[model samples]
Target: MKQTTVSERALVLAPRGRDAMVAAAMLAEGGIEAVVCDSLASLIDGLNAGAGFVLVTEEAVATADLRPLSDWLAGQQEWSDLPFVLLTSRGGGLERNPAAARHLEVLGNVTFLERPFHPTTLISLVRSALRGRRRQYEARARLIELRESETRYATLFQTMDEGFCIIRFVDGPHGPLSDYVHVQANPAYERHAGIPNVVGQYVRQMVPDEADGWVDLYRGVLTSGEPIRFERELIATGRHLELSAFRVEPRERSEVAVVFQDVTERKRAEIALRELNETLERRIEAAVAERQAAAEQLHEAQKLETIGQLTGGVAHDVNNLLTPITGALDLLHRRSADHDPRMARLIDGALQSAERARVLVSRLLGFARRQALETRATDICSLLTGVQDLVTSSIGPSISLRVECSQDLPPALIDPNQLELAILNLSVNARDAMLEGGILTIAASHVRVDALEVSGLAAGDYVRIVVSDTGTGMSAETLARAIEPFYSTKEVGKGTGLGLSMVHGLAGQLGGAFTLTSAPGQGTQASLYLPLAPGVAAANGLSSDSTLMEMEPLNILLADDEQLVRIGTAEMLRELGHVVHEAASGAQALNRLIAGEPIDLLITDYMMPGMNGAALAGRVGEINPDLPVLVITGYAGGDLDIGLPQLTKPFRQADLARSLYRLFHTGETLPTDCA
Candidate 1:
């Protein structure tokens, strides 16, 4: 297509010979482009050539045929009404002359000037006419842009995934804004909301049972000029929708633009997940009860052995189930780091459920006395103060919690995590015992234990942690068997019967003794007596200060049978500035060591095909006797006498860092019997 170009120059017409030439020269001197036309026919040709405005004398129009000029004026575009400046004699009064008046009517946009006018005045009039013509050209450009914009909007409206609609508020006989009339709707509006041919129809009329609140919601947005986003179930459509609504402006009549998406699938998934967690919790409880029942049939010594075996098997199975769940949730948590707030909350909920399951498994293992303990010197006063808020919240608002610790209390050697769990378990038990409101006190004090003051402990310094509750006191029989597994006086399904037993086992594992004192009328007090750690200051565990230490990166051999575990662990090691070589099996790891792979440290899973971690370490020992080895295991209970430092599976990056720091920074070595 040939494009039309609008000219910026003026067209001059004058029947008097020198008048037209003189006008063109004057426009030229004023920096305006002008062309001289000899007759009406030439003037029409110049108009078709896109002149900005016309300059002509009264004599030119009076002598020329007027029909062609009138036709040209009528044929101009809607946006273009070419300006015409008419020069007349000073006393001529063109209004009284019928011929001149008729010519003026032909030129739709005409400006008159007396012939004796100032040159500046003529230039000013010409400049004003050109400015008006330029505005018309601008209007034409804007119209073109508007047309293209509308085309793009139409395409987006038709193809968008979310439903979109614009509705103007409609007045009823009762009041204004009683309902909204759908003025426009996209294809997705019908598909997602299931309302068809909705344009130009009032909402109440289309959906007769539509909630009045929905109408009021849009009305509120219109009045407040505020946008709202929410999720709701549409009763009419039988679908869950996430809606975002905003007021459309020029709001004489209230109008709203709504964007919505059907989230019924997401809603269903949330419900299914909640139900799955409940089912899993019930299964775990039932399994624990079943194992406890079987152990009751055995002799006292055999029962402990049988329970240990059963606990290990259950722990292994549970760990297998939790491995992928925790791993996948960890990956999901990382992926959703920058996701929307709602998605982040959903991921956090899933992770919490997985963590609860892990805690349940840990409790079971603890009750069986099979869970491993990772003990360190911990300040008793600091640990109590840290968990004060948690303990307070765990007990309802009806109960009061008090924490008291001696200022000079020494550090106790214990596993911080297990001790926290034990204390939390005791607090919950106390809460349950108190039907009404009561006071729960957690206090720590330094005490000296004489001979036989505590079982399996010599005379030395100790920190005594006492958890006392002013709840319903337990009977003598209840107190005597409180530490026995599956022994509970609470109603069925209300208690797992393992809380106290787990706490007792945790105390024993930490080289501490747990004792409960209670009577029929008085409240109960559960005490944990832990030997003080020697040569460790109370500030050591409580201090948050850390300094970055420079250390040389080591060449490490990493082995795991599980691909995901291996990849995750290897990434952690590499992030810590170590060079890692991965092997899928013990045999492969041993082969690498034997092949002189120059491994400074060897980390291998305890269980693998062809040869186990212990066997592989034994072979590596022969190849390089001084090579440091760390064993990683998912097993709940087993002899860790391989004499190598062992870390439990599903450890965090910090855990790996600490282990490496202890092995390298402290110049520690595995026992010589690490084979």
Candidate 2:
């Protein structure tokens, strides 16, 4: 029920002027717009302009050659068929006249009225023809609207983002449908599925792997008359697709419409996220374990530091007490040289016992004190060879010893004596572990130490000394405290527990590190890392066997706060053929030097009541720049920089004699054995 604006008036064509006017007047009076034409040419023009109905006399239609009008009628639009009302004479017999009938046929939908008909009849016939013409115009409007709707639908189907395809099932040998063919596909279908030229192709032929299950899914939707949505991977294209299918009309033949989109990237991202989460969990577990281990190491270090502090305080007191005792023993031995033979034997025994005690005290002090290192370029291979015999004899013949030294190994910068002692201590410990006897291997090699490889050591070249024992190794509990002072695993009185602690101290003081590896059942391996020495020859210590030089007696100033120590030391110097002056304090010693007491040498104790020995030495240097001074101390604390000749306390007659000899010949070149 749509409306149209096309002309709804009647057009009249009559050669007879009167009849044409009459018909026009009648149509106008009957409420119809009418147009009258005087000739066939004018009537053709009127039809072209648009008219609801045509009024023409048979004479006008036949005599005028209506060919142009017939052609116009044949070319009419599908929705239009022009209506015509014809007026003819009653006795004309137009049906029998072929030419007249043919003319009449050209004007389609014609209504005939006789010439004698009443005016009311003519008007009614014209009205009927006009109504029919209006219906034709309405049909034309509906046809145009239908075409526009179809155009819009086609545009949407082709341009939508999701792929759309219509499939019709093909029948097989056993059933109504075995496969489906692509009946219609949009532009997006190829992009989403990575398949080109898909339309009009059967699903089985295009993607054979997917045909079996995919056809079944579509068939079920068609039979059940329900829609389905799911996801699948296309084997041919390697694409993940999200698909939705619904049954189309004519479902008995198994026709379906499908919409799909590619979701491969989304699926890949989900998997990557899951893997990242798993890796993060593993890293977190490792970090937690590292923190726990670090805490345990800190606790052990704190415990060892506390015990070292207590042991250091006790060792300092012992050194002080032994100073006077050893000094008196030296004096008695000298005086008892010609005593009874039995008394001389007793003296020899007592000196041996005191020497043993001194060695034990030195080990305790090594664990407690952070002493200055006298580092020198030492050939490690040669040093190890020198100690091999001593170490083998100490371990006994039950255990075999092997020394492996690499050729061209780098020299280590360390105190030779301390390193030798450390090696000896490690060898003894190895001997004790091998109750049933085992092989002890000592090896030396040149190695490069990276910064991260060792704690508290810089990246550089080092000499690595490894000691391996095929003996019962330590348990975890014992290994953890192996470097702690006085933490012995041996039975009471069997071990001092200071062996590894002293070695650890030596390594640290020399700017290196010590590492021990052991397990309950496996053998033990200990590595001593010493930094490579700057290129230089080895520094030798003063040799005890060096003969004393003959020298003229010189005036000497001997100063000490302790009366016993001062008197005892003065007597030893006097016995060594030197004039000795005594002073109880640094102030008293300075007074004698200021008064021009003819002092040839100044020997002062480091710790005195007023002004220490270093201060006295500095004052004496101002008075006599060339005066030689010797500083003696029982315990050399952290500050030992006196810039004077140093001699450790509790010395013998020979020790004083050697020191005096060196002082008199300070300007002369002495033998290297005095180093």
Candidate 3:
């Protein structure tokens, strides 16, 4: 402590002798507690003893090292600059020695008083030193608070996960420029950049790419003093780096602060999703196009079917007109005398040409679904034999036709005429494929299609009739479309494309399965599998004694909307020596029955205006359950879900005669001759 009259208590040191003791005594007499030290060691000891300030003799402590005392005082945290007064020697160079003056600077809060000074001067000097020391203490307190705040910020900066940076612009002697001097950085930034000691380094040293054209991004922020945020793709070594930059505001010159994050995975995922969506969109477009094409094809098929129906109706009417004309002409030829040879010859030639026209018309009606199917429980061997003869005559002498019938073939429930036509169609197709010469084989076998043999087929039985040819085989692509209607490999005018489609349609109508197998160089084979009629007595490939020509007249109820057909059919029935009644529609037929018209048979057209053939049958059954109805139409069994003995249109007088005769004479609807 330094003695002074500035306050109650003070300590003053003039020298290490009597002056120091006098000063201490004066302070004690003045009722002010104080202590004085002559040497640097005593000064430190006095300070340790709870003295607020120290009084020292500058000359006495001139040779002594003040470093230890200063260090020890500084170790007292906040009290490092406690008060002290330096008492100079009376005559020495205490105030003049340059070395001592330099060393005196070590005592930060010490005051100097000349020797021989008054008590008031020493006291005043001591009080002034204490005041200076008090000021230093207040400043030290403020410094401690600042240091704590700095420590808190440094801890946060080091521990944060995001990369943070601060930059500044320094004005040099030459010009003002921007530089990123890192004031603080986190561990994440150091690890991300693979760089150590990032703090205190310039941004140019950390990332050199930013100094290129992208520097404009940073420059804009600085010029406008605005916070800018943007993302850019950066290259770090060979790896792609997606960095986001945010420029801090309040730029002094052309400097900015930015923070960045890695978004590589997110970018890649977005790209992959975009590609997938594009691929899916393309697939959807393709599906839409395909569906549209299929719809168009279906529409075309339906239009063709409708046209066929109209053609079939016209052909039926023409056939009916031609049948009577040709028959009457043949009758006239027979009745004409042999003496009128020229007249007879002309009539004969005309009848022959009319017969050919009738056959062509019948084929046309068949294609149009107006031709009747005479179903029969028949031996397939005989039918195939018959087809072989027909094919041999029609396919020219170059093509050889053969029949390969299994020794014992089961009877199939099929139409004989349709089956023969199907065989002829196959033979013609084969002959066309061969062109020069080829062997056509019409074969039949009793096929018992068990469930295990062919999946989805019934375990009962089927009759497989195969027509194979050693002709030029079809490629896979050609074979795929071979069964489609109007598709053909033949040249124009050589053949109608309806051959195969008709065969397929007929097979389907017969409740049969048709399959075709062909390879590029291995020829073609078509197999037709028909359901075998139950309890049918197997044919021994011999002619049956009973025939349709020997049958009796059936009490036939001929129902047709066409007046010509009704009247002409009745006249034909009267010629056949049978009782015949006529009705226009199914409703009229039912009315005749209500009028008690004895009708043992109901022969009705399938298509009628008010009551269709099927609906009439159902109603007529309610009236006469014992009566057997024979359905006849231009569109019977042509994609309609109706069941009856349907006779197709364009029937001859003989055909109608034979159908009724056979039904009345024989109990079975199918003929004995094999299909």
What value does the lDDT take at residue 171 in candidate 1?
82
Query: What is every candidate's alpha-carbon RMSD to the true fold?
Result: 31.5, 6.5, 9.7
- Tens digits of per-residue lDDT, candidate 3, 299-397, equal 867866886787676775675566456555644564584778888999878877876776566556556665555566887877776566678887888
Off by over 4 Å in 2: 1-32, 37-44, 52-64, 82-178, 186-194, 211-235, 238-322, 337-369, 372-416, 431-437, 443-465, 472-520, 528-542, 545-645, 648-664, 669-675
C-alpha positional error of residue 615 in candidate 1 after TM-score superposition, expressed in Å:
1.2
lDDT of 2 at 43: 79
**Candidate 1: lDDT of 448?**
81
Clashes of each: 0, 1, 9
Clashing pairs in 2: 542-675
Candidate 1: clashing residue pairs, number: 0
Which one is best on lDDT?
2
Off by over 4 Å in 1: 1-302, 316-372, 448-450, 453-461, 536-558, 562-584, 588-602, 624-628, 636-639, 653-675
Put the candidates in lDDT order, highest first.
2, 1, 3
Please report, as a residue range, the 10-residue window in candidate 3 with the lowest summed lDDT: 1-10
